[model samples]
Target: MSTESNSRGNHSAENGSSVHHVVQIDASFLSEVEGKMEELPRLLNRSAGRDSCCIFRVPQSLSEINERAYQPHIVSIGPFHHGEPQFQMIQEHKWRFLSDLLLRAESKRVVLKDFFEAVAPMEEPIRKSYSETLEFDGQDLIRMMVLDGCFIIELFCKVGRIVPADLDDPLFTMAWVLPFLMRDLLRLENQIPYFVLQKLFDLSVGSGNDDPSLAKLALGFFNYMVQRPLHVLVKYYEKKGVHLLDLFLMSYIPDCEEEVRRPSRFLHLIQCAKKLNQAGVRFKPRKTHSILDIKFKNGVLEIPVLTMDDFWSSLFLNFVAFEQCYRHSTKYVTTYATLMGCLINTPADAGFLRDHKIIENYFGTDKEVARFFNNVGKDVVFDIHRSYLSKVFEEVNEYYQNDWHVRWAGFRHKYFDTPWSFMSAVAATVLLLLTMIQAFYAVFAYQNPPKNH
Candidate 1:
């Protein structure tokens, strides 16, 4: 009866019902067998905790007996992009890191003298990748600084200056994505603007780095691009509203040579919730999954990462796949595709209307923007001389006629013309009318008053 009760108790514990059990063991058996423990196996086996008994299968024998056992409690944490040992802390650190970099990059110096001094640090940090085995050539940095078109190129050729690096050691290696975003910030005049992004990708594919340091950097950099577009291309035709996302849904790049018609990098981004109100907002990863859930509940970010499903229903098909291709290596494309496919197959919000609202407006309306410039001073407003804006718009229209926006606009035109297409709608209508009339006459003619012929 005791054995039965203990067994029932174990079962109850296993079911999580919270039960208690008491077992009576022979004390003399333990004392007598204490010295010769090998002989005390029977007595030791049945002694255990509050709810169950510890059964010992006879040593070296597969004894199949039905006995209840208490299971050890287990908790699991989700995988993260990098050192997201804890999601909440990681998130806070991410922004803190960004603000620090921004101050160094943009706010540190304003006057021409300070700007020149800042360039000294920019030439190259005294030490690059102090924490990891990363080696950054000083010249390599000039390439990054001159990311914007005319400004960077002209500055490199004309100014020909050097800079000292500020950050000596980073707690974690910044992800490679961070470089692309910084380059984007340089105003998109990079000689090989997307080259950094591609190189990071290559690293992810085969660099065999266990940490994915460069990959994480790339993610952070792109996040910055979401907020600050490379101004040089901001006004360009094919480039307007284009993002760090190098590929489009219908874009022709493949994650791997063996892959075919795969998803683009843009889709995975939406699925990631990296963007807030369409602007890339910064976030840090969590150490544990539950913490991420709690943070999500509190609405730390403009949009919570967990809310990805809510937005998935609204993504454009090709765009969603585009993002998946970047989110992982080509080897995982099929798997990513399967998961996204499930979402695609389910009922979702249709998010395909190409938003023509200019990127500037999306940031804030003209009134607010005007106020920002006015506060900056009259010179700041005059800096973009109408001539400059006009020239930029004209050049972009001419050079990038086939850019994403331009192409999308052309497609919109084709779509809008459907009603007015003479050969399509009008001709089809005429043909339909003629067919109907003939059918009516044929049916009536058969009954033609048996004319009297």
Candidate 2:
């Protein structure tokens, strides 16, 4: 009986030791969790401060359509793509451009130190402009801001003829290189804040009463891509933009009244260009300040002439991506792309628009243009009631649904589509009338028994 009692005591001791070990582990885990909870406030603080984030990384749903459209090919401007290997050549040119600006600043009593000092106070705001948490430290970000900003300002000045460009500078001498550089500069990921450029410009090349403003200089450099008149561009020069891409986009927005809030509905896609034409809708090319200014009046649909090239394709893709990602942005570009996609469902639809001088197809064949629109318009989130072209869509769809118009249009298209067919139709009509008249005369002669002639 004593031995049995000793064994029970030993088992109790082992059970106590196991319980102690489990309690220790639970206490340690609880302490670790409590320690991690301390960081919640900091995370929330960072998130709350992100209201200034205007620049965004393109979301995967949009980028998956065309990854290269959102990425920089020749140059890297912002932290998202900085220090990339392929951009090293442009990185060297950035230094060269900075050197030129420094030389110019020397005459104005502005030094490199002045540029850095001007941007130093803006580091926090600059960091908050990007959507992602940047890995760049204070000194590295400041240097990037100064370098990229000055290079853009100098390039604009040189191109605008505000400052003379070097005779040997390949960026200006090589025509092909300038186009790619221009495209890269306007990319979504490849941008520094416009305020940084303005600060650098004000310090390095003080604006004169007669001299072009930074906005003007920027517009001048990118105007070739858009081909807007100077007067139209001048109107938006005073408006502040977040970055170069935003500035370029701002130029294309129509200077019209604010969009009025209307009842929301499911925005349906309209018929293709070929189908609309067959349904008695007329297509006309319009010349407007903004390409997004599309209109439908009566039975005619008017669209501004669009020049499509490789540069335009890339530009539009980025523009749509930006509108999709950014909340404050208007859906003008997105609406235009979606409208085009609705109108061009096939190669024949593209060809019809091409014949009407509505689309200048420099990108590729009609099939390619059709495919481009289809691809761009996919996976986009748009509210038609908020869109500027919502009225046009409603009118076009309403017109297309009319049975009388479609029947008449189909009849005309089938019988009188070509000149030969029209002539044959007229001749057949005349022959039928003559046959009826002859039968009536013969019936009258037989019934009345008139004298034979």
lDDT on C-alpha atoms for all candidate structures? 0.29, 0.85
Q: Which stretches of candidate 1 lie over 4 Å from their true place?
A: 1-181, 184-215, 226-253, 258-418, 422-453
lDDT of candidate 1 over 389-438, digit per residue (tens)? 22222222233333554454454445443576635656777899999999
Tens digits of per-residue lDDT, candidate 2, 144-196, equal: 99999988888998888888888888887888878888999888878888889
Question: C-alpha displacement of 358 in model 2, angstroms?
Answer: 1.5
RMSD of each: 25.6, 5.5
Residue 31's lDDT in candidate 2: 88
Q: What C-alpha root-mean-square deviation, in Å, does candidate 2 show against the real structure?
A: 5.5
- Please list the residue runs of candidate 2 whose C-alpha ends up more than 4 Å from where it truly belongs after superposition: 1-50, 256-267, 432-453
- Least accurate stretch of 10 residues (summed lDDT) in model 2? 40-49
Most lDDT-accurate candidate: 2
* lDDT, residue 243, model 2: 89
Model 1, residue 165: displacement in angstroms?
A: 17
Give the TM-score of each candidate: 0.18, 0.87
Instruction: Give the C-alpha miss distance for residue 102 in model 2, angstroms.
Output: 1.3
